[model samples]
Target: MILALSFIESPIAVIVILGSILVFALYYFNKKQVILRKLSKTRRKAVASLKTNEFVKVHGKALHVVAPLVAPLSKRKCVFYTIKLEKKVSSGKSSYWKTIVDEEKMQDFFLEQNGSYVIVRPVPSPKNYKSYLVKDEKVSSGVFNDPTPEFKELLKTYNIDSEGFFGFNKTLRYEEGIIEVGEKITVAGIAKWKTLNEPIPEYAYSKIVELISDEKEKLIITDHPKALKDSRHSI
Candidate 1:
């Protein structure tokens, strides 16, 4: 208790903590600015205006091009997904959070607006751009020791280390950001039209395009583009 009080009362300690926070904020915003500049060059168009064999930028709710995959932790049907793993560490009298594992996975899906839909195919590559709001949902959290069978399987699939240097003493939390059934999303890429093998109703166009992007153009997905304050997705 004496040590804690002394640290809090010390002006040097307070300044150091505040300075660290400011540095982190500046770094984050600077990176965001670079991303905004790239997105600004993308062309925006309504989904209905989307034509076969053309590159276009559009925003709308996400839908399953096929049966949606069930998120392992949340058990929610989604078209796109991302997961994060964190570890807790302590040193001396101070404790803090450390992220040891960060991974993301996604699948082909459709972006729809005003009853019009376009197929986004082959998942995005490392070069294709994507981002999300900070408001991701937490699926589960607990100590890493004696992990559940499902958790173990997930760790194995992703090759994550549940055991630290000494033992499984770390706390594990699973959180995900998903493109759900009806949530809004934005995408920018080339739409390559292909004819369908079978007839389907509601789709006036018999051809569906496989979306792709070049170095300059990118594939972006987000629930609320307005919240990001980026004009690229808004347009």
Candidate 2:
């Protein structure tokens, strides 16, 4: 009698097994191309740009160069970043180089020029640290000009300081610009940028050495959140 009962329950067992298999299959499919799904409005622009421009493949924290690669770093890559100030940041901060020299060096990274803002280098940093200057493209200027009602509503929903937090404070700025996975794009519409002589490889650890921008409060941020925190505290 027990054996017969076990056989009768065997069908139910098979159905349960099949359900588990189906769930596992769904999970795998989603995991493979998860990035394409996760990106939001930025994806639309990246995808559309790919039609004319070239984009590198970016997924799983991996970046592979596209065709006509300019500068490829075999070990590491460098990228431009932006950071904002959570509080007032000081300019006269000592770096490791100054300590080794046994003297306090008050280096002004943001130069006080005549009607111009210049970015000086930080001490203990490589003299030729890879960085790029992004001159505003003609179209990029208008990209964020007319704020949509939805964008405004989101601002209200978050209850954030629209002026301070938004436009480009030294904080919450460009942490990094990994190629949007969906954007298999090229540099067709974009203009030439002043960057390092070589490209940084995907595996390399990069540090943002300096912040260069016409905007006073704006700065470049590195991918490492810890470094940004340290920069804020140190200065």
Candidate 3:
């Protein structure tokens, strides 16, 4: 009997309390939603403006992102990350983030410790870098190529083997003495048939070196190309 009396007498108070809570929740959610939408818009615009080998700084890390986003995907508007990776981890191998971060709970990570990330655009050089492909023989070629005549000439001059085919392969950035002429290499990459594995008789280490050499020559020759490589290379 007493409970029935209390319910009837305070029905309006209960309604008012519920309404206030609902309003507060909606306002909080709406603010977050707006922030996320703006983030998505910015990312889309940034991606659209990206060049083949150029990367932009995002949440914040040094990621060599090959963009013009390969696959367009969407998540909550506040965050959308185009998938890029560190050297793919060996199954049992551990990386810096892998050790401290839970692979299974990536979202929770973004909510708290979003690091700054930068897309690493492939730099401009005169060489079409190839990966060493390894197939029946354990060697492969590079996934991407440079279509310059000078680049091709340098490869031929070095006697690099590019005959075998693969669908895709990756190469590292240009480095000094590490790239040697006449060095034999085994690589993995996609083939003409769209298969992503095969070894090329050649790799691009030497070619890239030669290309960098030629580029240096041109830079010494003038200020224009020099400025481009310098200013453009820097974020």
Candidate 4:
């Protein structure tokens, strides 16, 4: 007991512990802001001014190039969507939510601004990179309240049983986010121009550019108001 107390009382040990906690707190609170700052540093470019293989950023209304995807939980028409499912677990005197599923889907969309448009090709995320998605909608269900029919169907599609072995509903939460049609969005990536085999509506150029991600630069897309504000300020 005396030795343990001495260890705890040691100035070096106290300083090390406090420093570690401070580092963790800084990282936990500022991680997203750091990403936002990096995004803001990329200068916004006009669709007509984009150069081949140049890194660029753009903000405009999202328009679907093809059939829009239906958000699984909300059933909203969107070009991109992310869904998360978590289960509540208890141990000893403490309980925590454990993530059971995480999935995202996206398709090519057009960013229209000032009578011009550019295609945005969302690249498949590499193992080292994660796409930042905003999940604004959330729902929870537990023993007192059962999941809705639609929720049960979603769980079934994931092959996750909504009930325990004893036929009791398990505590679960669902979160979803989507980039709906006509929503303003910002995107940053490497730009490449390609020749169109056929012309599309609302664009007069014979060649159009598409924003894509590469090994050095990962594509970033967000609808967060703060991020959007920062982006505009950067411009």
Which candidate wins on TM-score?
4
Counted clashes in each candidate structure = 0, 22, 44, 0
- Which candidate, 2 or 4, would have the higher lDDT against the true structure? 4
Candidate maximizing lDDT? 4
- Quote the positional error of residue 59 for candidate 3 in Å: 15
**Model 1 Cα RMSD, 1 decimal:** 7.1
Q: How do the residues 28-114 of candidate 3 rate in per-residue lDDT, one tens digit apiece?
A: 566334333323332221222233322121222111112212111121121112121212223566533222111110010110112
Residue 213 C-alpha lDDT in model 2 = 28
Decoy 3 TM-score against native: 0.18
What lDDT would candidate 4 get against the real structure?
0.81
Model 3 worst lDDT window (10 residues): 104-113
Candidate lDDT (C-alpha), each: 0.65, 0.26, 0.24, 0.81
Candidate 4: tens digits of C-alpha lDDT, residues 117-202? 88887755453223455777787788988999889888998999989989889999999988998998888888888999889976
Q: Decide which is better by TM-score, 1 or 3.
A: 1
Model 2 scores worst on lDDT over the 10 consecutive residues at 97-106
Pairs that collide in candidate 4 are none
lDDT of 2 by residue, 1-235 (tens): 9999999999999999999999987875653232222221112222111222211211112122332111111112222221111222335683221111111111223212122221233232423222222211111111234433443333354353334435642211111132221212111111112334443433122321122322222122112222211211111
Regions of candidate 3 where Cα sits further than 4 Å from its true position? 1-9, 29-65, 72-235
In Å, residue 105's CA in model 1 sits off its true spot by 1.7
